[model samples]
Target: MRGDVMGCSSQSTITNFSPQIAEAYAILRGIRFAMDAGLLPAEVEPDAKTIVYLIIADAPPLAEVGIVISDIIHICKHYNIWVLFTPRCANMVAHNLAKVMPAEDLFYLEEYPPYVESFVLDDKAM
Candidate 1:
């Protein structure tokens, strides 16, 4: 559901969107790219399901997220992955961490701040 996504160019890659939207787009794109590149096993293809739940602290311009979501859904349908949206509360620790932590720290759990445990557990639960 929630993830610390990094290394995405919001300006160019995610059109007319906020940084958070771009970040979400990057994860979906990354998944598709990984599958196409043989990084994800072929066994996880059509009929293999993955539940994708993305968490956001603030509501985005739904129109933009919709467009990307549609595309993501199409690809996911091909791979049998279900995509879901969830609202995240402001008190979520990952939100605070993203505002202050370095990119590398956000990527790996061992490197993240201790408070991120809640976020990680919620992500895994999804």
Candidate 2:
């Protein structure tokens, strides 16, 4: 399963849980909701071959995330979704955007500040 870090804006998507894994799952749910609403790439159809782009950060308890990741893997496996791990640097675009916005106004791209594009485009792997 994919795993990654998000900026503070994604904090809302996380459930108010003490464990990192639980918090991380909340973000995953938010992402799934966005996909349902057509925010992410349409190529990742749920019924067809699905792909999850998990953004990961370098931090402690990577092993814990690995355990939680197994759960994600199981669910994705049931749905035929492919999980991809992306570095935090690559995911910084979303994280940076999340940092400056009001919670109510976080997810919309049209409302994002101009600087976020630099982070988004900076990922050479793309």
Clashing pairs in model 2?
A: 4-55, 4-56, 5-55, 7-95
lDDT of 1 by residue, 1-126 (tens): 234422211112315757555655654654564464444322111111122332222222356565665566566556644434333452244344434534331233224455666765655556
- Reference-based TM-score, model 2: 0.45
Best by TM-score: 2
Residue 103, model 2: Cα distance from true site in angstroms? 2.7
Q: Residue 67 of model 1: what lDDT?
A: 61
Model 1's alpha-carbon lDDT is 0.42
Global local distance difference test of model 2: 0.43
**Deviation in Å, model 1, residue 58 alpha carbon:** 19
The residue-level lDDT of candidate 1 at 72 comes to 60
Separately for all candidates shown, the number of backbone clashes (residues 3 or more apart, or on different chains) is 1, 4
